[model samples]
Target: MCGMLGGLLLSAVLIEGKIYFSETFGEGWQQRWRLSTWKEGHAEKMGKWQTSAGKWYRDEVEDAGLQTAEIMKFYAISASFEPFSNEGKELIVQYQAKYEKDLACGGGYLKLGPSTEDLSKFGDSTKYNIMFGPDQCNAEKRTHLIFRYGGRNFLKKAELPYKQEGEGLSHLYTLHLKPDNTVRVLVDLDKIYEGSLKDDWEMLPPREIADPKDQKPSDWLDEEMMEDPADVKPPDWVESKMMVDPKAGKPEEWDDEEDGEWDAPKIENPNFKGPWLPRKIPNPDYKGTWKARIVPNPDFSDDPDLYKYSDIGYVGFDVWQVKGGTIFDNIIITDSLKEAEDMAQKWKALREVEDAAKKNEDEAQAKAFEKAKAARAARSKENKAGDTKNEKKDEL
Candidate 1:
């Protein structure tokens, strides 16, 4: 009986440890993902998702995924799958995004939720278990990491680090949720944030709070310093900050109507001592700042499994962009961090090659543009000289 039980437990562990879903958006990706629509009566505008090398490419066209149409339009899309439970396991979500147009304002993020029935209705009101990615609008550019708690969505209390500007390069964002109720956020495979879920997220009210009935005593001397009674103002101190020059007088030949009325110019008084104040000295009765006593919060409750989500059935992007040319590809969701990291490494290698190709192409284009500009300038100069010579001949 013991041997049979061990075998069954091992099987369950293996099943939970494997990759739940992974998509590179290679050939026939349309079968796996669905594009959402915005409807007005009979008119429906489905979000444009077409394959591209994403502003940079190697010789291989297979290394592309569906990119945003990049126009004055709204977008909402999702790809659903079988419901996967993250309970008692590490949930890893990873993906790559490229802002080819150096997106000035847009959301390049993904949402994971349980519902898949009405992806077209996905909007700001849609609830999600997790929302992670870079978002920028005007001066505010940051990675958004929001989690739903007790039927309400709560954003991370700490500011998520993200780059507002882009260099037309692809970046990978990864989120690792460990079974121990801890989370780690990474950008480009580098860990940017790591902490317990309870500390970083306000999932619950604080365990303790300042006692309401307790207050600082009115007679408590919190000030560290006081004015020195011994210090006094000097006898020669000038009261006025500025004074009229006694040696100067009105011009003798001045006419009131023709010339402006002559007046002695007021200058800063050298003898002036700005305000009179005694020097500060250490206060004898000084007391430290009073802090209210803390007690257990009445409403505080503990939940060790706050990081666990029951079901995550779909991954989607619902974003608005001013000038969208963002490409999202190589999405992976698994229970193993090692699997996610390995996937990121594979994508990183491809990005290096594509980036190099883009650099070379840019240089070649710049040189060609400069050569054309020079030729145009030379022709213009020759025409001007010929016109000048014809003008001189006409004068002759």
Candidate 2:
């Protein structure tokens, strides 16, 4: 499956040439990137952003990517570049993200937008051309792929495939948008969704729709079955669900003033029959569901270049994290899927090594904890014995 998807992606974007922009955070990344200190609701409190080369996996740490402060409230940060257009070429956006603190509620996504005069003022209100990546809060875990169309942002109509179970591991997310108005989403280089933009998003009204002039007749019988006219309820059938118990009687010694008023006990009725429902028979006049005839939608106008973005000058992370420890690295915007895949392959190799080291560290830590617990138990037993001896001496 991986091979097949890789082949398909290669065929799709291999024709496109140069990379528009790329960021690997090699050195002096702080100078290139800008951090946002914006708080929720324009509140006084704000989150601070910091860069890190090490990622925390449980107690183990591996050298990699940028991380937010461990106690972040709400954070936003971005990096800007000169405007570039992907007018008639495939646009590929790929990045690696890891939530090392097992993100319970947060967004580990990035946004692509046109140039803003102030990168420091970037926040939720900033207009973005494309926003894609992982987001999880409460029980909802989704991969958001929102695109700005006309004047509003629109979310993809189809269910986005996202990683919901794992954490502390880096996953590569890649978005491929072609000039033909089609898009594909890949996680770890595996294609999760591939469909046309018009079919997946409400970017435009459908090309055809049910005719407004056509309507179902008032006497149309769409029911598949009807109550049997010949069937009748038996006279002996009882509908009551409960009845007074014949064997139950009030205690003779009961005082009306002190004790509650005597009453017969209620029990399940032995002769109870469920509410009578007439038997159903096939409806001879039944017609299947009525659907109006379709006609070409007058409002729809095709736009073959819907996927093209004229200017995408900045890429940033505008997210709200409950428990922050997400690392963002290796952001690349290119016109080549092959370049993205090559980068992904490098990250995948590094992830495997990191995962193995983390597993070993976790195992060693668990063993050490168990050994310390047993030693503590022994020491506690000796202390208790010494206290008992002192108490005996005092008693004597």
lDDT of 2 by residue, 1-396 (tens): 346437758765455477777887766788888878555466544556665655443223234577776554677888888888888888899998877676778899999999888888888899999999999887888999999988788899976977634556777888989988889888877778999888889899999999999999999999999999999999999999999999987888988898978888899998998999999999999999999999999999988878877888999988888888787888899887777777776567667766787788789999999999999999999999999999999999
Clash pairs, model 1 backbone: none
TM-scores, in order shown? Answer: 0.74, 0.77
Error of 2 at 129 (Å): 0.7
Tens-digit per-residue lDDT, 1-396, candidate 1 = 213212221222433366878888787788877766544352334456677766565434656866887564567778888888888887889898888776667889999988567776665667789999999887788999888878888888987988534556778888887777888787776667878878988898999999999989989999999998888878876778899988778888988889877778898888887887779999999988888999999999999888888888888888887788888888998886556666776567767876687788889999999999999999999999999999999999
- Report lDDT (Cα) of residue 287, candidate 1: 89
Question: Candidate 2: TM-score?
Answer: 0.77
* Alpha carbon lDDT of each predicted model: 0.78, 0.81
Q: Which pairs of residues collide in model 2?
A: 53-64
The local lDDT score (0 to 100) that residue 87 gets in candidate 1 is 86
Stretches > 4 Å off in candidate 1:
1-16, 38-47, 163-166, 229-279, 337-342, 361-396
